[model samples]
Target: MILYTTTPIEMIFPCDQTVFDNYKTISYQGVPLVVEQTDNHYRIVQILSSNPNDFMKEELAPGQLISFI
Candidate 1:
């Protein structure tokens, strides 16, 4: 996993979002993404695609929509 900040922050997954099992995978914009659950937070793991900008890693707040085409 890539760490942007030194300290790790705990995140609350969205209740309305799809429940992901460990090692489960999904795709966004044709890019494959793996779902990983840690002791504290869930993660969207993916390999570095050709377009780096296509993979967005950020904290998602409540009521925010994560739309994929």
Candidate 2:
């Protein structure tokens, strides 16, 4: 039931298993993502890796700090 903005124009609704124990990070197709909590929704803060594939997801791409709000 969690929503994340992985790309500038897209959002990824990952399952509960994708959420990390810390609740600050999540795995989307194996890419670790950090998110910032907004008043109404969550925003993509950063990618926890430098791998090109990490930012290649249609939803969570580099330079695309998408917000669900």
Provide the clashing-pair count of each candidate structure.
Answer: 0, 3
Kindly report the root-mean-square deviation of model 1 from the true structure over all alpha carbons: 10.0
lDDT per residue as tens, model 1, 1-69: 666742213323434344433444555456555445555544554433456555444433222233432
lDDT of 1 at 3: 60
Best by TM-score: 2
The lDDT per prediction is: 0.43, 0.57
Give lDDT tens digits, candidate 2, residues 13-54: 345543432236666557788775545555566787769866
RMSD of each: 10.0, 12.5
Candidate 2: C-alpha RMSD after superposition: 12.5
Those runs of model 2 whose alpha carbons end farther than 4 Å from true positions after fitting are: 1-23, 62-69
